[model samples]
Target: MFIEERTADDLALIRLLDAAFAELVARYGLEGRSGVGPGAHYLVAVVDDETVGCVAVQTTDVAGTGEVKRMYVAPAARGQGIARALLKEIESRATDLGYDRLRLVTGHLQPAAIALYESAGYRRTEPYGTYADRPGTFCYAKSLAG
Candidate 1:
């Protein structure tokens, strides 16, 4: 599979994001929300020219930090490392964009996602931003500095 940077509005990436939102809503019984915004960076994973996974990063209020958003891999594409690759690519792009750290929030219902982030070296962090008071939200952060 090949992964490359893409725009937040890319059609295929939008479809993936929609699917991810739907899954989150079903899993968490909450309304879907969009995380893409101005200046966000996106990366898509493609296999046989078909986009199967995507991730994005956007600047956070915290200086030198970025927030990871819209990380998803199609259900059929799981187990192939697509999500992991997309995440790694986005982290690299965020670091290149001058972010010294990255943070993300995922619901506790998503054990697989939590495992992925933890296995990737992210550690639990105090909730921040809109998630600060939201229960069941699992916040994590990882420093990009070497």
Candidate 2:
């Protein structure tokens, strides 16, 4: 599979993302929500010309930092390292955008996601955003070379 930047309007990407987010909410009791905003930056993974995974990142209000808003790999596409590639791609883009750090919040129930982020050089961080103080949220951050 190959990864590339894509619009949130892509029908396949949207459906995959929706299902992924719904799963997160159900599994982790998460409350974070998503929207099409100015800060949005999205990427999708394609295999055989079909979108199978996706990720979204946005510059947060905090200077020098960016947030990974969403990441999803279709069930059929899991275990293929798509998530790792997407995370690395986001960090590359964030670094190019002059961001010095990247932050993301996943849910406690998603061990695969947490492991993906941690294995990608991200470190656990204090809670932030809508999930702060929520028992099921796990936050992470990675410093980029500005």
Candidate 3:
């Protein structure tokens, strides 16, 4: 698999994000939502001319940190290290974008995501975004500073 920077505006990326977001909402019984807004940098995992996985990072309103969003890999493509590779790419891009840290929010319903973040060196953080002060929200942060 190859990981490369892509635009969130790409149709393929949007389709992937939409599917992932729908699954997330259904699985967690939350409201529907789309991916991040413009100015977010996207990374896609491509295999055989198909986009199988994707992740994105956008500069948060907060200083010195970027927020990670829309991370997903096709079920058919799991266990192939695509998520890890995409995350590492995001970290490198964030550092290059002058961000000192990265933050993300995931629901406890997704234990796999929680475990991935924990094992990837992200620690619990106070709720951010719409998750603020909400129960069942799991926030995580990791330093990207050298």
lDDT of 2 by residue, 1-146 (tens): 88888786779888887888787667744454545357588888899988888888887879999888778888988998888888888888878888899888877678888888888888998998665767867889988873
- Model 2 stretches with alpha carbons more than 4 Å out: 29-36
The residue-by-residue lDDT of candidate 1 on 28-79, one tens digit each, is 7664464577988888999998999988899888999999999999999999
For residue 58, model 3's alpha carbon misses the true position, in angstroms, by 0.4
Give RMSD (Å) of candidate 1 vs. truth. 1.1
**Model 1 clashing residue pairs (backbone):** none
Backbone clashes under 3 angstroms, per model: 0, 0, 0
Give each prediction's root-mean-square deviation over alpha carbons.
1.1, 1.8, 1.3
lDDT of 2: 0.81
Q: Could you estimate the TM-score for every candidate?
A: 0.95, 0.90, 0.94
Q: Sort the predicted structures by lDDT, highest score first.
A: 1, 3, 2
Error of 2 at 59 (Å): 1.1
Q: Compare the candidates by lDDT and give the number of the best one.
A: 1
Pairwise lDDT winner, candidates 1 and 3: 1
